[model samples]
Target: MLCRNCLRATRAAASRPAIPLLRAGISSVTRSATYTTSTQASVRHTLQTRLPALPTFRTYSTSSSESAAPPPEKPDYLNEAESTIWDRLVAEFEPTELVVQDISGGCGSMYGIEICSPKFAGKRMLAQQRMVNTCLGDLMTNWHGAQLKTRAP
Candidate 1:
């Protein structure tokens, strides 16, 4: 079954003759009128006559000439303990990416740490994590537990 729009297009094409070229060709002697749907014509008419008549828009693009966004600054929301841990890790690793969160209801007893650093390039996963833990040093003694993740950048 033809959709509402397809039905309309088929009807429109049937009622109006196709626009002939400037001059009939020799082949026109034996030519027959094949069926055509005016869906493209209807879409073009809609865009030309209706959409641009309104003030909002006519076209859009997925590209831009602008540069990429700047890097994120250190978070302002961290508490004292979280800040301390962030500083210690930053100094030791010079990481490309780092995140430290207190997952223990804001009491700062348990933390989740993720770090990516060039210093971890030749290390295994266990060794990378060990480096982070060793950098934390005496501070880890105060924590009940930690969830640590490390990656080579």
Candidate 2:
């Protein structure tokens, strides 16, 4: 008598159902059998073998109380041009405190500024100076010059 397995194999050979052979060491069978074999290469290409999902990033927003109010606007005595340049520098540096002294009268339109910013952390003195210079590109063009003193927070 013919074997049942042999009969099944004969039928399968006559009308073979499409099957996919994945790269060695990968899944033996496609996730869905109904998908055509042409998709197998793409499937294999796209499928990521089981791996741990990356940790999601979490962001926390600060309440007004959590952060201090912005610094009071500079006094009226401060030159408008000087104040504008100072405010831009302070905002760029996010300094603990910035002091801009206009020595322009003595030094021919030159100002001395001291900046303290957490952003300056780990940078060399030259790099810190360059950072301030880069931020003040527009202001620098208008003013005759500046003296930068930067400190890391």
Give me the candidate number with maximum TM-score: 1
Judging by lDDT against the true structure, name the best candidate.
Answer: 1
What candidate 2 gets wrong by more than 4 Å, as runs, is 1-73, 106-108
Candidate 1 global Cα RMSD: 13.4
Per-residue lDDT value at 89 in model 2: 78
C-alpha RMSD for every candidate: 13.4, 14.7
Candidate 1 residue spans exceeding 4 A from truth: 1-72
lDDT by residue for model 2 (60-111), tens: 9997566744554566777776787778876777677678878878443788
Evaluated against the true structure, the overall lDDT of model 2 is 0.69
Scored against the true structure, residue 76 in model 2 reaches a CA lDDT of 72
TM-score of 1: 0.53
Model 1: pairs clashing at backbone N, Cα or C within 3 Å: none
